[model samples]
Target: MRPVPKQRRGVTPRARLRVLQLPVVLWLTLVWVALWGELSAANVVFGLVVSIVVCLVFPLPTLPMDLHIRPLRLVWLVLRFLGDVVVASVEVAWITLRFWREPRNAVIEVDLETSSDFVLTVVAEMVSLVPGSLVVEARRSTHTLFLHVLDARDTAGVDKMRSQVYALERRVVRALGTETQRLPEGGTP
Candidate 1:
């Protein structure tokens, strides 16, 4: 007879590690080091202890996260995001230089395809990083963002802004979102 697999009790080692939020802990430690403006064994140890204490005191919020890191897609996303930043910077600069042509600013709403808070946060941050737009409000419950857009003068301009935001959201999903968050019309996110 085939032996039955033993049942595991309590949390596994991986689960315990997840609870520690290693990436966040490491980032906090790095920030502490930078704040001190020095690097030493003692500093590293102290930073780590402080990081752990802070993490324990105020734990990271638990989101419905199922991360599947695709290295290639992540690289592409970074490159594309950088390109967008440069282009937007130049455009915004041009707009500033031509002050005579008053740019029409508007608050446009964008409804993202995914309800994942992680995806929403990433999208909002990414959009805000690019020039010519900033997220004025984010409604997690509705999975929507209200962006203050520069030069959105008309309905067509508003539509353009909406599409641009949607495109950014799609890229974010393909970069880090789960398989279940695929775009509509059989488009792989």
Candidate 2:
């Protein structure tokens, strides 16, 4: 009997489709349908085909992420995020109107407690989506995110922003992180 050859480390032909996640493909198809502004069967089929083709042709960079999904925590996190979005939108609009002439902008670096890259990415994305702050740099080695914030007038304001960011990170960790990486109850880490 002949010995069998070892399988390669890279993705196999059958696994190519697996590289494109179901949620991403669905979202892409939805986007295509929305852009065309049509709800016909032909549109749905076309959108699905296009989404699949795009995903196959342009494969995304894979991140080896370790995710632990806590359903109840996730629900709470979503509700809190939505509320924050509304409040931040209003606050930022007010700030823009009030200080159109001399807006206080500052770049602040926040050190995150968790060393997980996935958590870091999630936190950065969430912060960027909140309107007034955008992540300028993320250093994985130091687990620090540098954000450019608008309307932070003074040192106290900057400190407050830092505190808020830390608080957000804490919440994110509590929502999705495993016990090993999560902050303690006393919250001194």
Candidate 3:
């Protein structure tokens, strides 16, 4: 009889791979359900299967992340994001209505304090989701985001947008930052 190989301790590579793929799979499934506009058992099962196939076909490189979730801060971040959306929507509507004037849009570069790619991606997505701004380019090397902002006519407007990006970044870091990540020197807005 052949001797049995000793079982490895801790997580096996396959288990680790599954754990890493879980988030992407779940997110893809959620997106599928959302796109269908209804949640049914069949939809969920199909979505899961499709997501799994997609993940297998185009596997993503996993990053070593030290994510820490603070639920209260996350709720606050969502509320703040919603408020920003409302305010930005009104601003954009007003800008559109003013037919006599050309809206002054500027592409500004914001150097984010956190170097984490996860944080950078979240911040960029949030900024892009708001009505008055969009993330045009992200520089991973410098941890910089270039956003095209509507109605940023002057230096003060540019500064305000820059500060707003920082504030959003601060909120993101507070909500989902790694254990060792430190908030910038100022108190949260």
Compare the candidates by TM-score and give the number of the best one.
Answer: 1
Tens digits of per-residue lDDT for model 2, 66-126: 6677788778778888888899899899887884468889999899877777778888999
Candidate 3 is scored at a TM of: 0.78
For model 3, residues 1-189, the per-residue Cα lDDT tens digits are 224334334647685466448889899999999999999999999999999888765655566677789899999999999999999999999999999999889999999988787888889999999999998899888789999999899989999999999899899888885633556576765
Model 3 pairs in collision = none
lDDT score of residue 89 within candidate 3: 97
Clash-forming residue pairs, model 2? none
Judging by lDDT against the true structure, name the best candidate. Answer: 3
The alpha-carbon RMSD values of the candidates against the true structure, listed in the order shown, are 8.4, 7.1, 8.6
Model 1 misplacement above 4 A: 1-20, 34-39, 186-189
Lowest summed lDDT window (length 10), candidate 1:
1-10
Better of 1 and 3 by TM-score: 1
* Order of candidate numbers by lDDT, starting with the best: 3, 1, 2
1 versus 2: better TM-score goes to: 1
Better of 1 and 2 by lDDT: 1
- Tens digit of lDDT per residue, candidate 1, span 1-189? 324334234646665455577777899999999999999888889999998888765655456688887788889889998999999999999999996899999998888888787999888999999999999998877888999998888989899889888877777777785644457765434
